[model samples]
Target: MALRTFLLLLLLLAAALLITQAQGIGSSASDCCLKHSQKAIPSGVVTSYRLQGPESGCLLDAVVFTTKRNRKICASPTDGTIQKLMQHLDKKAKNDKNKKKGQTQRPRGRAKKQRRQQV
Candidate 1:
């Protein structure tokens, strides 16, 4: 009876771990857009955004924008203006990430000294 109980518990734990891992596998690409919004987000007020493709299970390709008011808005990805803005934001994000990587690769004290010397 003790051995049977232990085996059952082990099986349950294995199943749980497998389910958890499977859920995480494609979670980062999952749909995150809300179904409703109280008001429209103004043009050029997006602070950040992410593009979600059909593979992410959204009904359509979506541009999930984070507005200056900190509200999230979902817009049609087919819009040309949205597409351009998404591309611009993507480039800006990449540049910012590269700058951070470069900064981190240098020692802080050395960076400060170099900046002081240049000035």
Candidate 2:
């Protein structure tokens, strides 16, 4: 009975270790982003962008952009143009989120229509 109990405990320990390792591998894979390049891309060519901070595990802060050529580029955070673009994108995303939230919170009934009609 003691031998059987020991084997069961060992099996559970092995399963826990495997689960931990799997989670680590999955998180690390997701944490990685496109590697940064040194070549400069013209401001007019970038179509959209999002900022990734240091908490994202990247070597440095990066601005990931989609270009008119259908390419994704990672630019340096230190660049003034990239910084301004990121701020604009951040504000736009915030406004869009708030608009969606407001729409969802409205009552879906004749009462809402009546209230709107009164105003």
Once fitted onto the true fold, the runs of candidate 2 whose alpha carbons sit more than 4 angstroms away are: 2-24, 28-35, 87-119
Query: Which candidate has the top score in lDDT?
Result: 2
- Flag clash pairs in model 1: none
Model 1, which residues run further than 4 Å from truth?
A: 14-31, 34-41, 54-60, 88-119
Pairs with steric clashes in candidate 2 = none
lDDT of 1 at 70: 83
- Clashes per candidate, residues 3 or more apart or on different chains: 0, 0
- What local distance difference test score does each model get? 0.73, 0.74
Best by TM-score: 1
What's the TM-score of every candidate structure?
Answer: 0.48, 0.47
59-118 per-residue lDDT for model 2 (tens digits): 556777888888888888788776787777677679988988889685666763344556
lDDT of 1 by residue, 1-119 (tens): 99999999999999998998778665654546654343555557877987676566555567789888887788877777677778877887899999988986746564433445554
